[model samples]
Target: MAAPAATAAPSVPPSLSLPPSQFARIQPHAYLLAHLSPPSASNQPSIRANGRAPSQFRVTSANAGSLTHTNGSAVVRIGDTAAVCGVRAELLHTEDIASWSVSQASSSNKRRRLADLGEKPTEEDEDEDPEDDRAHIEDLNLLVPNISLSTGCAPGFIPGAAPSALAQSLSHQILSLLHSTRLVRADDLRVWYQQPNLGPEEPERHNENEQMDVDAEQSATIEDKPREIKAFWVLHIDIMIISLAGNPFDAAWAAVLAALRDTKLPKAWWDVDNETIVCSDSVSDARKLSLRGLPVASSFGVFEADAAAGWRANVIPDATEQTQTGKKGSPERWILADPDGYEEGLIQERACIVVDKQKDGKTTIVKMEKNGGWTVDTEDLRQLVEISAQRWDEMKRILDQC
Candidate 1:
């Protein structure tokens, strides 16, 4: 079957309407200049005024507490591109009372039986009350690009349809990166309960090591002690891509850091063994999430476009400049660092670098993804590492302020 004829552009009020040409003309400065500049000045003054090379970064700014409704909220802006993230916290509760009531009854009965046997209920019970906190965390969803393309960057987007598939992929990359690095700890939100009164007949203390002889007639069974304290904090990160001026990864990272800065975990009472959760309102009752060091990711583009030859290879940085220089004129493509979107349009190879910093003033590249287009010599890789180490402390300072 033949494809349906394209429909005419929808007519709307002049003030609210924009032409396709107008939208297309609003491309990134890097893109526009790359094509418009004279060959003599093609690469001159192309980077931002902040002293960043075309491949370098601008002065990234991040701020927290932009929203009152959320537990935490932050805005991260890199040049003109901006991303806002808000964290909303809600306690987990049973949908029906029957299930909860039954569980409570079973626990109470077990305690009663232990009391009757002249055994004291252990302090272990104090911890079980917060088990539900972890469940609350797992149920949370981090909505990225939540506002979608309605902001006008993506014209003619279908209603109810998500931002394009590419947007989803990028968002997932940001979300998964945050999760795997343990940037947000789930156990810091626990709130303890009021002390329960013990009956007069109960023993003052019971030796935990001493086991009671099992009797068929007895009504109490001791549960195995929990090995790990359950996580009590539930961080619900909502990332809204306010504007996509390119460089979504950096924008996402800055947003996540900012969101965490103002984040306050709600106090919760928990039981690990029983997996129960109770929300607490007092600030004194809550604990802060421990922040591991910031693990930042950088991507470089390796573009090799020979329009005359009718050949174009768009690739990310798979090797450093030193390596490519060593094999000067080698058709084998390789890039040291990931460039912005415009650079990607002309790249033939690429690489991804993830740097991890230690508390002892040491730094190392924990992860590297390299492609075969080019190779990075050890010396140039060392230079990149040195640059990262020098910049990491500054980055952490910026993150801490958020």
Candidate 2:
């Protein structure tokens, strides 16, 4: 008789059953890209979701001054992404800031300086101390920005915990961008306070506290009037991401622009007697903040021919020929501007381009960020900028309408 048939091995059931397609099972993002990618014509994506052109952005909507408490506020929506920005202005006494710097320098920084070199500061160093006075403490930190990304905005964010690294980095980036661009007028924030002359006996008053950035020759000819910035307007800008589909930077930038444009600061007067600044409560006394330029941000998702087509296509195009060692070559990428969440996940290259149209009609690039490992040529960047300019115009038109 035949040897007892080998006992059949038991089969273990699969823990999960994935989609039938190989890419769908192994890489869901690739499957999504392959199935949902826009139709191609001439090796380019021809159309996007919802019948949009490849370069077209999703519908944008903005509403200004949405919050009552804030000096200015706005809600901006870019497709499924939503962000709310609020601006609040406060008066900061220049003297107080100088004093704090001086105190801190004297107490802590001075100790560090002494400890580092094992010697006291030299006379020249003392004379050149940056914390000595208001002029030396040129703190251009008038605008403070914070970004909030709670669990409600996205699934990964934990509730009740401090903002994630992503949020903090975004916040710092926004602040740096605002400062580098000089979007707000510096002169507008300056306001002076001076005591009245007693019985018109005070000589031409000249003091360091009453100094201005006037030229030496210009100061000699000017009349006796306080031009010093005793107090300044510090704008506290808060941006909250309520919903995120993709492209947080673009949505946040739009919201910030709208809110800042709508900003109105209450008339503040420095009280010589009280040594404080008094802000007017009347809405009629509120003045609109000066805006230098409006910068619009455009985000793009880069999709390579290999990834975009995935397993669905018969042949995948590579940017460069493969080497004899069988190593993969560079990939040819197509940019999808204002990509939704699904498209963003599959993309390896992302770019955020900011453009501002000056009053004289010249368009300037405020900032451009290209992230991820994919390589983009100058021609592609030029094309991207052209699209960004067009999108900026579109965003401006929408803002103007609202």
Candidate 3:
């Protein structure tokens, strides 16, 4: 048999395997798209790489008054993103401000005129002249909001480094929203004192025969001295991002809202003898801030299914089915709510809706910010608003419990 025919070497089929994590790391776009747009034969509902539905948000939790040192403090977490916010109240004397006198004079005159007209200032009036209503807060910079994200909260963020551009941008956005919403009332921050009127130099009425009774009667008839602003409580809102997975703005804003709601400034009064403001030490004397409305932020990202279409076309041998279905030319898109870090990296288009639902069952859109893509339209905005309303309800309930 001629050396016993050499047995054909057994052939081993080519094989390769990779863990899900390794696959995601190597092919992020493909990995996400695979979940978002599964094969037609699978008949699976579209979902995100993080195992959440397109419109689903991560669970949120908040805890107020967590820090004892700060006047108001809150810890908030939305999924893996977590933040701590503190509100510290400091007194700013009117005498220290150069423009306080001028602004106070103008404001007093306007108030007197409004009083004379016998018409109380209405929301419509304030809306017509928002700049005037916001003058004190903006001009004085009473509300100082700063966001810190340099504590190695995420990759590329080195601890102890200077604030990154993202941090500055978030700070600006928070400050802008605070001013636009007028969430904190200026009246609550004002510390007023009545001026003592020394009526026309009474010349020391020590003698009983000097018509002391007549002078007393006349003084009683005189109108009360106008109350002047002695000082204002400046709120320094500091937010620190402990962990950032994505959707940082929403977490930051929620922490701010919760902390502000928990904030209670001490009752303060002007001390003439010391020529300074005095704050009550008793806990019972602390007063909480009167926030105008609960404005909640909801952010979404738009991911085009065709982000890697070109790569797929190059890799796949056949394009006949894709061309016939027209999917190759026009791929579908998804609006992902509360996108995580992985999803945020793959998405470019985004929209943020800030809404406040009133006690009267009316929902008000406080602000809407969108950028990067035109895939979202008016109908999409309406749907986002509905989603935001539900989010607002959830946040409200959590905050109330806190």
Strongest candidate by TM-score: 3
Which scores greater on TM-score, model 1 or model 3? 3
Could you give candidate 2's per-residue lDDT for residues 1-402 as a string of tens digits? 778889889998886855545645578654555544645654654554345666879989999979999989999999999999999988777777846456545545665777688976654554345443333223647788899985788777778888788788889878777866667765556565544534322345587443442344344445333234577788889999999888888888889999988999877877777877888889999888777778888888877656544432224344222311226645445578898876777777688888988778787998988877435657778988899888878888988876
| Candidate 1 off by > 4 Å | 1-51, 93-150, 153-161, 189-233, 270-277, 305-328, 331-341, 370-382
lDDT of model 2 at residue 17? 53
What is the Å distance of residue 402 in model 2 from its true position?
A: 2.6
Candidate 3, run of 10 with poorest lDDT: 317-326
Ten residues in a row with the worst lDDT in model 1?
A: 305-314
How well does candidate 3 match the true structure in TM-score terms?
Answer: 0.84
- Per-residue lDDT for 1-402 in model 3, tens only? 557778899999876987889999998988999999998999999988888999999999999999999999999999999999999999899889999889877866886898899965654464345565588788999999999984668888986788889999999999999998999888778787866665644667767867677677668755534567798889999999999999999999999999999999999988889988888899999989888999999999988777764455457745535633556454678899999999998987799999999889789999999997556778899999999999889999999998
Clashing pairs in 2: none
Across 1-402, the per-residue lDDT of candidate 1 in tens digits comes to 999999998997668655544643454433433432326645554332223453455466788889999888888877566788887765534432235456455566776798799986556453333343323333343222232333554343556775687567766776666655655544454334433333233334456332232232122322332223322334567777676655566677667766776777766666645767755778777545565567776666543323211122233243344344655453332232435444444544556566878768678675666564543556546666665565566667777776
Candidate order by decreasing TM-score: 3, 2, 1
Q: Which ten residues in a row have the lowest lDDT in candidate 2?
A: 317-326
- lDDT, candidate 1, at 134: 29
What's the lDDT for residue 351 in model 1?
A: 60
Question: What are the lDDT figures for the candidates, one per model?
Answer: 0.55, 0.73, 0.87
TM-score of 1: 0.60
